[model samples]
Target: MKINWAEDLRERVHDLAESLGNLFVEGFHYLALFAIGGITAWASVMAFLGMVEKGHISVDDILLLFIYLELGAMVGIYFKTNHMPVRFLIYVAITALTRLLISDVSHHNGPGMGVIYVSAAILLLALSILVVRYASSQFPSEVSAKPRTRRHLVIAQNRAEGDPGES
Candidate 1:
């Protein structure tokens, strides 16, 4: 058979372009991870310094440290497995709400609208954790050992909620 050199060249160029695109995306991912890690480290150090200036650690300081630690862990997990769970984010948010609530009670004149908002945020984060757990169990990506898609989880959740057209 006569060779189609032009078609072969085009296919090779396409594959090379795809590979370069993937490489660039992966490189950007790692760069982001490193940037996050560095920023978290800096924030943790600054928190520690602030605590020192205050002569000791307070509840708010501790909570802030925990938030920073959670952020670092989130980035680390994403770098390692690329399976960063939403639960980590929810946990961070709950901790932050707790911190805010504490700050509001201590620093404000009295109980104000901030308390209500933070309390509601904590409740919402808790509910989100529950929803995430249910989704993981009902449509387990780990147990099935198959390539699961976000569409699967959303469709399943919508079906269960009687909102078939949600997606």
Candidate 2:
């Protein structure tokens, strides 16, 4: 038997490099998630404190907090599952647009065409959310699906025992 030292060494080197690269990428992902989570938490707390200091909480303040809550939830989900939830983003956008509309109405004497435009945008976002949810339910991603059990061991055992039709 002939042993190829250079080929074996190359394969080992390739595996090591691949492992290091994966490790670095995973580490960066974790670090970035932690930073994002921390910043979101800090900002949320600051906003809450500011509202408290003002001694009055408005609908806008509550909506802002809800936005922060959604962001925090999004970050946590991404950190755990490594998948982004598009619905959460849509929810945030809807809340933000509502806030903008309310702000505009309260500041101005009357609602303008801008209110209609914002409302339309919110409606579109809502429809997109429904479509996304329906599509996800109809055709789930393979990566998100539960892993199927392997039958290789049972098949191999059946073959070794000379059992016909077991496999």
Compared to the true structure, candidate 1 yields what TM-score? 0.78
Pairs of colliding residues, candidate 1 = none
- Top candidate when judged by TM-score against the true structure: 2
Across residues 1-167, which tens digit of lDDT does each residue of candidate 1 receive? 34688866776687677667878988999998899899999989998998999898889999999999999999988887778878999999999989989988988859888788889889988998999999998998753444434445667888998988545
Kindly report which residue stretches of model 2 are placed more than 4 angstroms away from their true locations once superposed: 1-3, 144-167
| Location of the lowest summed lDDT over 10 successive residues in candidate 2 | 144-153
Instruction: Please state the error at residue 77 of candidate 2 in Å.
Output: 0.6
Please state the error at residue 34 of candidate 1 in Å: 0.6
Give each model's whole-structure lDDT.
0.85, 0.87
Error of 1 at 86 (Å): 1.2
Candidate 2, residues 47-152, lDDT tens digits: the string is 9999999999999999999999999999999987888999999999999999998888888969789999999999999999999999999999868353222344
Error of 1 at 123 (Å): 0.8
Q: How much is the lDDT of residue 74 in candidate 2?
A: 95
